[model samples]
Target: MQLFAFGLNHQTAPLAVREQVAFNVDGIENALRDLVENGAAKEATILSTCNRMELYCNAAKPEHAIDWLAEYHKLPRQELEPYLYTLPRDLAVKHSFRVASGLDSMVLGEPQILGQMKQAVRQAEQAGTMGILLHKLFQNTFSVAKQVRTETEIGANLVSMAAAAVRLAERIFPSIEEQNVLFIGAGEMIELNAVYFAARNPKRITVANRTLERAQTLARQYNGHAITLSDLPEQLAQNDIIVTCTASQLPILGKGMVERALKARRHKPLFIVDLAVPRDVETEVSELNDVFLYTVDDIAEVVKDGLEARQGAVKEAEVIIESGVSDFLHWMESRDVVPTIRALRENAEHSRRQELEKAVRLLAKGESPEKVLEAMSRGLTNKFLHAPTHALNQAHGKDRDNFLDVARRLHHLHNDE
Candidate 1:
């Protein structure tokens, strides 16, 4: 099977299209197993983030994997086709390196994609779908990411999505210190945003998650209150600023929920950042007069704060990634020759064993040790030269010249010698 990757990312698809294919964290292992079990791939690892849904696989027919993706998501093949990008072999290797190094992220040089990729690899491992090719690819991928981070200023002055969310909130509110901040979901994204918002000393901070324990764990870190997702409706009205990123398959904050919250707050403006891919807030919520709803895509502009400075390091990072890709491809190419090399060694060993047995018999028959040793050495030399000599003798014209050249090279011979 060949190494290949195919998927749609934020660069090629809008948030709406991306969300349709987004694999929830809980179902990632199942998705990976299905991809391999369905024969679309020999091995597969899926990297699903807020910005992209990509599958890197070792497969004979990558198109079948693409078809599987659309089928799995229940999206028409035609509908998903426009945004899809397929990379083969070397291109796939380079793309993986670029992605892991954060060159391919919506927010350039952002470090979060690296962690997300590592998570994808872990999920693939848990699913038992990670085979040698993908394992090697990601191993090189992460190594390249580390090299880039160390050799370049790609991560310096990085404006993360969480920081960007806080910046957007600042625009909406005069003072974060006075506004009540409620974070929906206690995942990494929420925790990140919490760090940024908490630093501002918001009047009240709350974390809402599917499980209260997880919520409480995060809440206690910021000296905030915790609530289960079921408490959102009642708690929604109390917060002036809301940041949400959850793995829920459906919109958690519907238009009606926001409308009720707005009414309870006497139509005071509510700033909401929905960072989830399968959005936590309904699109219609953006239409509400008193509600300012921002999706992950909407945060892109704000996240460009240090983009100019980071761009300078991109070329440096690309150089490192390209070198990594070359090294990985070379390793793959060497692997391709391994079976041939093994067979060659095994064949030579068989010849040696046969000759040694004969030598033993002659010695047992009272031949001198010195004579036996010389005979055995001659036998080994003849056995090693026989195939090439026979092939060179049989060859004619250009083939003869090719065989002669190969024989000389194989034995490291020179015309002078």
Candidate 2:
């Protein structure tokens, strides 16, 4: 089966497009089943984060997989076409390895992507969508990722997007110590941002989420406060730094709402880092002179230059990944021939067993053992040579030359012999 990866990511798609297509955990399993049944793929797994929405699959037709993604997201193929990237086979395997190893993350060398990928695999397994091909590919993916981390400085001296948010916040006010930071969402990205912001000992910290309990749990960790999403508009003016990452398909903050917050904050320079894939803040808010709009990709740019600081290790990482890619592809190739190999071995065994059974029966009937043994040896030789003899006679041209060589090799029928 051909392996393919088709979808959008931080590089190909803007947040507007990627967010529209992001799949939640529950949505992933259903989408995977839909793909397999729709003849789009035989095995599928979707890895959806705020920054990327990639579908990895084993398939006969890559286009069918693309169509499945478009149809499921209810997006027009024409519109989706611009942002979608399609990788076949080797490139697909390389992309998977890159993504899982944190090389493809918004923050280079971050470890979160590895964990996220493992979660995706577990979800695929639970849905029964992970087949031998996908299972082995991911098994190698994790191993390669681990090797990259350990063998190279790929993860060294890396600045996380969350940490960069804090850096940007420092630029707004002379000191983060005086400002109150409000983190919007309780997701991993938000949690990380909040932790970084809280370390500054902000005047206060608050977490607002769709669920009050989740918000409360996160807020309590930092000795701050929790509020439901409903409180955001009213509470917006009170915070100086706002970091948001949520799974909401729609914009959490509109331009008008933020404008109102800016008006209330009295033209305060609000440092806003929207880590959400689709975005927590509306695009129009970026137009505001006083508001800073930092997207996931925007944050990615800040840490990018620093990754060069660890360039000594990249060549080593490539070697490790190459070896892993070779091993994984070899395993994938073997899977295709496995059944044929089994059938061939069974055929050979069956032929020998039948001849041996006949020999044993003759001996049981008190026939001469020597004649029985000779007959069995002749039967075994004939059975072994029959298929190759037929193949050599039937094949022609390239097929004939190849099969003749194969047959000669099989029976040790060399010119010298």
Candidate 3:
């Protein structure tokens, strides 16, 4: 089986297409198990984030794995095919290294994707879908990532997605200190945004999540209050800034909900940043007057503010990635010859055993020991040379020249010798 990677990311597909294929954190293990059990792959790991849904697999037929992705998500093959990228062997290795190093991220040099990839690998391991090939690939990938981060400034002056959300909010409001902030979700992204926004010292911070306990835990960090998602309708109108990132498959805040909230607040302006893949907020809510809504994609431009400063580091990172890819491919090539190397050793041992047995029989028959030793040495020599000598005698045209060259090289024979 060959190493293969196929996926659609923020660069290849818009949020609408991405969300359709995005796997939630809870479903990753099952999805990985199904991919392997269904004969699509021998090994598999999935990296599903707000910006990308990637499957890394060791499979004989990569097309089968591609088809499996569409089938698993209930999307037509034709529909998903346009946005998908299929990388095989060396390309797969290079892609994995680049992704782990943050070279392939939508936000150049963002560090979060490395953690996300590690989480994906952990999930694959838990599901028993991580085979030797994938495990080695990720191990090398993480090593390369560490090398890049250490040797270059790719991660310096980073404007993360959370920071970008705050920047966008600053553009809408005169001052963050004057506005009340509502964070919807207790996930990492929401926590990040809350941290950034909290530093600006919003008037009041409230965390709303499906579970009150999780919300309460996050809210306590900011000296704020917590509420369940069910309290959103009643409490929504009180907040001017809403930041949401959740794992729910459906939109948590629909257009009707936002419209009512706006009405209750007497048409006060509301700024929302949704970092969720399937979207915690409805798309139509962007159309409402006095409402500014931003999805994960919308944060891309804002996050590019410091990209030019990191272009030099990108070159350094690419140099590191290319070296990594070359090393990994060489290792893979060496593995491909293992069986042949083993067979050659086994064949030589068999011939030696046969010759030794004959030598023992000759000694038992009272033949001279010295003569029997010479005979055994000669037998072993002939057995070792038999295959190459026979092949040389039978070969014709270019095959004869090729065999001669291989024989010369194998025995270290010079032309003069």
The C-alpha stretches of model 1 lying farther than 4 A from their native spots are none
The TM-score ranking, best first, is: 1, 3, 2
Total clashing pairs for each candidate: 0, 0, 0
Lowest lDDT block of 10, candidate 3: 187-196
lDDT of 2: 0.86
Model 2, 112-156: lDDT tens per residue?
Answer: 888889889998998888987888889889999998998788888
List TM-score per model, in order.
0.97, 0.93, 0.95
Error of 2 at 305 (Å): 3.9
Q: Report the C-alpha lDDT of model 3 over 268-302, residue by residue, as the tens digit.
A: 99999989999999899999999999999988888
Off by over 4 Å in 3: 356-375
Pairs with steric clashes in candidate 2? none
Q: What lDDT score is found at residue 372 in candidate 3?
A: 100
Task: Arrange candidates by lDDT, descending.
Answer: 3, 1, 2
Residues 14-70 of candidate 1: C-alpha lDDT, one tens digit per residue: 999999999999999999999999999999999999999999999999989998998
* CA shift of 70, model 3, Å: 1.1
Error of 1 at 33 (Å): 1.4
